[model samples]
Target: MTDTRTDTRASAREILRTLVGRDDADFHEGQFEAISTLVDDRRRALVVQRTGWGKSAVYFVATLLLRRQGAGPTILVSPLLALMRDQVAAAARAGVRAVSINSSNAHEWAGVLEQLRRDEVDVLLVSPERLNNPSFRDEQLPALISRVGLLVVDEAHCISDWGHDFRPDYRRLRDLIATMPAGVPVLATTATANSRVVTDVAEQLAPAAAASASASAAGQPAGPGVVTIRGPLARASLRLGVLRLPDSRARLAWLLSHIDELPGSGIIYTLTVSAAEDTARLLREAGHAVRAYTGQTDTAEREESEGMLKRNEVKALVATSALGMGFDKPDLGFVLHLGAPSSPVAYYQQVGRAGRATENADVLLLPGIEDEAIWQYFATSSMPSEHKAEAVLGALGDAGGRPLSTPALEARVDLKRSPLELLLKVLDVDGAVRRVTGGWVSTGQPWVYDQVRYERIAAARLAEQQSMIDYERTTGCRMEFLQRALDDDTAVPCGRCDNCTAAWYPSDVAVAAASAAAASLDRVGVELEPRAQWPTGVASLGVDVRGNIPVGERLAAGRALARLTDLGWGGPLRDLFAVQAADAAASAAMTSACVRVLADWNWEERPAAVISMPSRRHPLLVASVARALSEAGRLPWLGSLDLVGGGPDGSSGGNSAYRLAAVWNRFEVGAELAAALAPFAGKPVLLVDDLADSRWTLTVAGRLLRRAGTSAVLPFTLALRS
Candidate 1:
């Protein structure tokens, strides 16, 4: 056994040398241990180390050694597309032939499967969602599971509900590990798991221990045990600090004034897509070469931006968390956050992108007052509610084995598109439903909603948010505080952070630059792209809508003064729209801003009249904006569209089809309004509203006016709900 371990270590060193292109390259302290356990002992192992610690090296080296012994290809389940791309490139440098099967390269899957069949690929990297895909799960996964020599779970923390970014799809990995042949080694790795998450993941990695006490009850035999290896969670090259600015303008001013002084090219992180886009625009106007990256960005453009940042062609990428995890740049010099994340684990994961290969890197956080609200939004969205789950099950059961598409399911449920999809994924994992070629069908299996478990998870998330709040206000060492939060035993004062030493970042902002930033943010006008296709399954609700909306019935692409989540006016808008706040007319500043927006709008034919959508909650606000626009634009004040009945109340929140059904035919053109609109028969009319959320109300109302003899309708709102 000793000789075998020694041989494994020697081969690992050779592979490491090839991987880094240097003869003297060696393994980190815990890398060899993990490799030896997997290659020689053929045992399961969990490795929890810091970001830059060589976790990939362990898997690649183990794959090379195991393949030399005539084992089948190693199957690696990765979490992110960027991570898979980087790993494929890293494997090539080590002389290992690797291929990836993910959503981006569906066209290449046939060739990849052929390579796998021929044993031409050494490593096969795939996303976690692919495991549940109907064709792959039924036709390919079983054979691959039997033939795979080793299994690797990267970013394994996501498997645990205790993790900050827990993913339901990753929980499917537990079953996959259980079915592997005995003695086929398994390895799980992550950099951000706390003690609870680490324990949870380790149990999942070794199913035998999890089943040992309940084997008889479960009617299955125990499998194998696991070994855990954890390392210190400190990044020696990072210099951490926090800059608490009073508002968005100050934060933007600080970036404009100090971006050049930062060490090298890095990322500027934002909490929302609008913030990223707005910040990137303002920075470019101030003469910085930067780009915005978010989930909304095209895949090709995202890849190009990643390459530009890697090559140091751009100073920074104003990005959301979309750029986190698996992006590699050895010389990245700085990372700045425009707002704090909800948990230290997530924050550490983002900041870890910098200073991986450099001697020093700057890490700074600019906490926002609205951070908690953002956190609450995400937290509530992520948790699956019992009511939604029950609604989905009922819908599936009613289908009677007929597969139902997501849109069809959305029409039947009260949840929105995204939350419904997430709940469906969770149900798929729990075996209550199945995804077939057409869509999803009920399994007719009895499943219980674990209310106790879900409540516990919600409580844990709230605790983490409080911990994050404490992290920002802590006067102690910041790095040490983060390390302790992750339950790292070796955490200590780094003597490098701002708290440990003196202030390392500039706090003063240039007055002129700040004024410019304020001006840019204050300038509000966002284009609202019109919905071209009517939602599917609307006919099921007795509505005649189906397929593409007729061009004559559609509203023109419209405009909003700002998004309710915008960095500039979002705070005031949120306050004004709060449930507890009293309904009032629009403020003078808001009215002025709306008038300026109208003044700058370049219409093909100027609007001949202005009309308001009748509102129940904010009637004064909507009426005030409509009157102001009518006065400023010198257009006729067409009376507001009259509500037919009670109209849908504030409780209406659901998918597109349902939302449309709620408001369809709910408004009728009164005699006075019809007469007022007749004069504008051959010209455009500006339709004003207090807010635009699903846009279903606007679409239905716009169709009514267009049919009532208006030539065109242009929708405008005080704010948009993204």
Candidate 2:
């Protein structure tokens, strides 16, 4: 009664404390005090929080504090649809009313506006791309300005070119924020952002700091200073290994063998969607649970696969670079690359999906010599041509504001065949034409993806690739280089990569380097995982073994091995020995162990299984062995094993042809095809001249061999070299 105002304030504080206590809210000392200061000062704040940091709490607390002071609902803009959904769910759990406004609900504009006007929604999330919508200003925005007390942008770095995945609309968000009611607060957050981006965002949101109370006096610095966090990048528990391959088939086989180690949680990234689908099909045929994700997959399928991945139903996912944005899964143990990614930014984001919970994880990149060519393709191919652009604009035929299909326009245009697609793509960007169905429609204005700007973007990428190549081949601290590039001052040497591992302890590196060099004489050099039919009574021998008994022993191991060696591997057998035995009884109980040792020893993949029979004149022994080898038709090229008995009549009694199953193994195809395939190790070598005019044939064969395991990949040629 003596002080009614003071009593009311005290009662409100008690109610707030009790509500927070219901959720077991532990007061974070100084956390809210700083936020309260930011609110009181009415300043715009951009916070950079590392992964696992409670960044949401910062904005969350700010929202609650400001709303308590009679400010309006908070407007949060986020780029990801999934993250938005999760936030909505979390809001319900926290007893806060939230509304999401996105393209999906464009028809419900009126109802959403009504809710915003009534102050029924405490938080509203929107996509940046929606700003261009006609209704943003006409019907919905008035309520937004009147009710939006706090403005929050999640993943705010998307506004900068340096961001991992840039979305053009993010840049427009800054201007949109500036249009907010005067004195309304703004807050932004990102898991990663460099200093330049931070400064740029600050300028965008509060350009007129002096007019607002949040601004520091004249030349004074702002309060609640930016805090930079530090942490180690290496997870010591993970064992890292790097393996280089000659082509995709060997890579495929290696992945197939180790797939048991990967589960529904692992990811396999390819350079393109076609490759992803091919790899997925191959894995599926081998009876593994797998799926593929690409930019082109229908939205429904993409969502289903994503749900399956989250539920741990799909064992493996093959995808292009588009699948990795903000995808958080702590159990992801492995991130395997079927090939090198298009860029280091793509590479980093894909690999970062693993080891979220600090559990042991692996990131594997199967680099090949041809990788640079693919990188060059993406770097060079996207450029647009002025000629093409002209053709496109000409196609519009005075219809400036009309929408058209890009494909249809391309068909009508007469530009250089190669650059036409890029030109139309550019026009879509320049806003001259918006993408519609398979074509483009005129937008009455210029856009970025148009022909004129295509070259500029392409040239920039080429330069970036050049820089990446230099960094990739450099002999320096990788983390340091990355840190320097990202403009972070605290990047220390991450002693886990090839270069850092070598630099951290030069003595050990030097010793290992020398040992490797010395051991190279005996080592096979070409590293490959053990083939499926490993250690199975097969001796892959070289034809140079002209000695009768040794040759006989090699021959007896399996005709497949003998044939492979005779094919040309025999030419290099002195330097490289190839043998495989998948039969446990034929070798030992430790087939997997032997394969691991061989992998370390640089042994490559070869068909290594064969049926064996002891030397015996007995008909049953000969007949039984012949039947078994004949039935084991899977190792077709790997000749059958027939241990010759001591008698002169052994050859006559044993039926060598049937026993070896040369007919089944195709040994009977004469030494020519066997000889040709022998060098390939079952892989199809691209016959250039053979497919000079019939490249389609070679392409088909390549697809078939890819489905089969570990086939030799041949180079595209003008004519057959063989």
Best by TM-score: 1
User: In candidate 1, how many Å is residue 513 off?
Assistant: 1.2
Candidate 2 Cα misplacement greater than 4 A, ranges: 1-40, 103-114, 136-138, 162-166, 192-242, 262-264, 376-397, 400-460, 463-481, 495-722
Candidate 1 residue 170 Cα shift, in angstroms, is 0.3
Task: Please give, for residues 1-722, the per-residue lDDT of candidate 1 as tens digits.
Answer: 89988888888899999999998999898889889888888988888888889899999999999999999999999988878888999999999999999999999999999999999999999988899898998998898988898999999988998642356889889989989998899999999888777767867877556434232111122345667778899999999999899988899999888999999999999999989999999999988999999989998899999999999999999999989887888789999999999989899999999999998999999999999999898887788888889999999999989999898898888788888888998898889999999999999999899888888888888888899888898999999999999988799999999999988999999998889888987987888877789888888887897999899999988899989889987778888888898889899999999988887888777888999998999998898999999998888888788887887784546888888888888898889998877777878899999888999899999999889888889999998887
- Which candidate leads in lDDT? 1
Estimate TM-scores for all models: 0.97, 0.55
* 257 Cα displacement, candidate 2 (Å): 1.9
